[model samples]
Target: MSASHPDNAPAATAASAQAFQTRLADRAAAMETTLTEIFNRRSAAPPRLLAAMRHAALGGGKRLRPFLTVETAALCGAEAATALPTAAAIELLHCYSLAHDDLPAMDDDDLRRGQPTVHKAFDEATAILAGDALLTLAFEVIADAGAHPSPDVRARLTLGLARAGGMTGMVGGQMLDLAAEGRWGAARLSPDDILHLQALKTGALLAFAVEAGGLVAGADADVQARLARYGKAVGGAFQIADDILDHEADAETLGKRAGKDAEKGKGTLVTALGLSGARAICDELIDGAIAALDCFGAEADMLRHAARFVGARRS
Candidate 1:
């Protein structure tokens, strides 16, 4: 899937897509193993807390964010081993968000990944603790010398992860989402507003995933900026695709509650753009994401495939 390939070359594109999927699967399995070992090493922790953490973090979703981290590192010529801990940290933070998002006070979902959510499998308190633990542990993982040889690189990863997960990013976006649910009598937001909110909530950590790879590779500022842009674009596309899936897919397919956005009157671009229009927006973002990778040429084929997959994924 070189950038020079003709647009009409379906065979090459198909083979590239297949290769990307295989790589994604292999990376995800490796991540699963790494996470399992990390958790197992926490033997001194309370048994129930450890169980709740494992329930939330292990045997999970596509692990796309971590894949992005590892792949982006590879794109920058870093070894997979050097990126593994950082990738695991991102997944831990993501799982923490999911745990909290599924709480009774939040989305109130009973299912996740076709299994009972942590709150349902354990108690709400345990689930909350698990999320908190995961969130804190992410910092520890990033701070460890194993994540990067350079102390400066480790610091950069820590600071970046903090900003992405903190009040200005994911948490801020979550607050805005709650307000948009008519809590502040603003059930409908402008497209720009939705973009801003989603960019913060969903896009921030994803951007970090890409940028963390750059940090690990000691990439120059220009390269890091390009990868950040690519990540934000793909992240936006991912959320739009999620909105479309929520409207069209069943709970069985989603592995969680479907149509909750509409049910709760949560304002999304889908409300303003309708299904077809939302799809168009996603396509545009995907194109932008791929374009952001133009500087990397063939080295970015995996990322190009990732952007497309985010937009077109069924779940």
Candidate 2:
């Protein structure tokens, strides 16, 4: 295996990421196609509802979560083909979160990824169903993928995704976020508290993404530990960058409505730490994430690039 982060640590410019992406760009594109097809064929689902789901999911984004799954699996010596379903399943779960998060009852955002939100594109009820369908379908995708592995391994993967996507993880984190809104005075959230919240809300699923991918690839315990640390650090960095973007990025560039965090009175790393401080924290998390890959050797360069992408992505 190659070093996950080269001592040469090439600066992660868009040009650099694009170059590294070129290495696996074809594979990633193929995975996206397969993932889209799989998502479109669920349960002979209503065409309109299915269209809504596809619309929200297929639109452009970094696809970072799925990439993490596939890339981590590859580094662990698992074929990317074998990990495709897991990657797709994680993306579905992520899409579902974004769908729900954009609802009238939630973030109430009209734009996502430079397009109307699911609820806006379709109707609220249809968007709700679309999100629910994706959430359930994610489990089904994982379960089907697990069938290819030994029964025990399959069971473990199912359990890992379920735990991470369910009440104890992503959903739970959302609940905490809802409660934390605009209560910064009495609640008086500290930076640590904010980090913990983001870790659960945004980082838990990502943590699960890396760990589950490693498990599927049959990585050793040590490798799994490294992957987990990498995921957590990268996940935190992703959210911190999100905060920075929300603060400073423009709508056209971010692909989502900017300044919603401040508009909603949401407490974030940006609000808690000032712009420069938040940016500094993002840099720190990127370094931490790269350091976590030190044991993986050269194979981890893509993962390092991924961390850079998370820290610096425009959208």
Candidate 3:
């Protein structure tokens, strides 16, 4: 890593990658533990539904959304522990979305995170209920006193999540996506339309994730704005990266059906702009995301690293 030894530049890069992965894994583990405890306190609920809920929420993945929340909170001078409840809440909401998205009426996916999806493992009704329960419990987690001592913080986080996942957010985007696909005699979407849908469907939650930390830390408006911008760019990059992977990666590598977007006639950045153009947009988003954090110093390095890592997702 010594600058004097330029010959080891590649080695240094590899070391840095390893360290970032290690850091990511550590944060993911912490979030997993919180989720485990939350799911464990449901003895009164029906056993099967609880199991299905657990299956949906506890399934293995990168846990990136919650990781961003915790990391952004840390960068804004909040303790990771203090931010964990909100982080876990966001993760639960994310899992709920995935579960519903994989339903026959939605994305109709059979696999998730390399495992049989909730509907396939259980039943469609169970999967639906699990997703519903997870979504409802997410609010409960965020509203709980444990999420933040200040009632105002909890309220703001709750409202933010509602707006992100509600009619004007993910739900609206899903509707737009279906319409764009001509499911009900809808028209074809232009590139701008696709971008707007993506911002609502995918970017909203991520924007909330990055901003959640600041809310937890009581960060000023300017810091919150920076995190919001960073989160938005990162979310854009993630979707584009995923679009590229869907075309390039196989089922085994992607943990789900590949090229489903194309098969379903979905309009994506890739479909609209082609592979090279989509990648260029992704690169620009990553650069902008990193630039958004320049207001901070070395403390924001992990976030900058995260922007690249998220964009780099592939087979």
Candidate 4:
């Protein structure tokens, strides 16, 4: 079902959102170039490994998470360009997660981004190593130059990113998801339970993305709080939308296997609340996300658009 948001801006008003997507894609390509050059500088890094890393990371993605990092920083009066490395680092980590998630032990999918998954394109071992490399390199990129300006701030950024991306964070959420397969479904989760899972699994990194930029820009406590709230709401909305797409979108449009969640008996908002219910929850979450940005005044327009766009994203 096409969802309706309560905010004044029609979702279609986010026309500039598509331009942001293109800009993010271009920036991510440059990030890949830099990473490749750094790896090639060291002859010890195997060409095959490098190829696999690039294959997964440089593969097509919406780049929404990274763009959020950059734009959030910009909204706080910092130069968005200064946050490129941080943005790139987050994207690399995200790609790593996708690669591993598609492995035999995880989601066990064979396609990603309309092409062979990393494990399918190469060997399983190669795919594992590629994920490892990207995860490690993500830190290197973050520590390079674009960190929040102060050494303590930089350290905080590192810690936040690690927590958001590590086993205690996204991984923990994934484990819960895996465990919940065939058992919990969506009906079992209290709104609180749903919030708990999404906060860690989906919200944590997004919180980090927005907060990292704010931290870099030396945002005050109030700004950080607002961004964090916005991040959490959007993150939950994003997953809800994904859950909807899992049931509604076709594989060709989704760029990966659709209905995999249902096939695997995984719990999802739709599975819990049914289609209309999930869509309503998504709209509510989007409203909450946009509301969190009210403190930023008109400057937060992009963020408001982004929140709506997250709910509207197809993949």
Best by lDDT: 1
TM-score for each predicted model, relative to the true structure: 0.96, 0.92, 0.95, 0.90
Among residues 3 or more apart in sequence or in different chains, the pairs in candidate 2 whose N, CA or C atoms overlap within 3 Å are: 2-297, 2-298, 2-299, 3-297, 3-298, 4-297, 4-300
Which candidate number would show the highest TM-score if scored against the true structure?
1
Worst 10 residues of 3 by lDDT: 1-10
TM-score of 2: 0.92
Query: After superposition on all CA atoms, how large is the RMSD of candidate 4?
Result: 2.9
Write candidate 2's Cα lDDT for 21-109 as tens digits. Answer: 78556656866796677865664878998899898788576677777888888899888878888888888899999999999888888
Write down the worst ten-residue block by lDDT for model 2: 1-10
lDDT of each: 0.88, 0.81, 0.87, 0.80
lDDT of 3 by residue, 1-315 (tens): 113223311333776768878989999999889999998887788999999998898858888899899999999898889999999999999999999999999989999989899999999999999999999999999999999999999999999999988878888888888777778885778888888998888888888899888999999999888998999999888888888999999999988899999998898989999998988888888878888887887788778778887777764
Off by over 4 Å in 4: 1-3, 6-44, 145-148, 182-191
Question: Of 1 and 3, which scores higher on lDDT?
Answer: 1
lDDT of 4 by residue, 1-315 (tens): 134654534344345667655665765576566555656665577989989988897747777777788788889888877777788788888888999999988899998999999999999999999999989988887876545557787788789889999787898888777776634444355656666776777778877888888887889999899898988888888888888898999999999999998898776778777898988888988888888887666667767777877877787
- The window of 10 residues in a row where model 1 has the poorest summed lDDT is 1-10
* Model 2 superposed RMSD (Cα): 3.3
lDDT of 1 by residue, 175-286 (tens): 8988888876756689999999998889999989999988988889999989988999988988888999999999999999999999888878888889988888888888
Stretches of candidate 2 exceeding 4 Å from the true structure: 1-16, 23-28, 145-147, 183-186
- After the best TM-score superposition of candidate 4, give how far the Cα of residue 103 lies from its true spot, in angstroms: 0.4
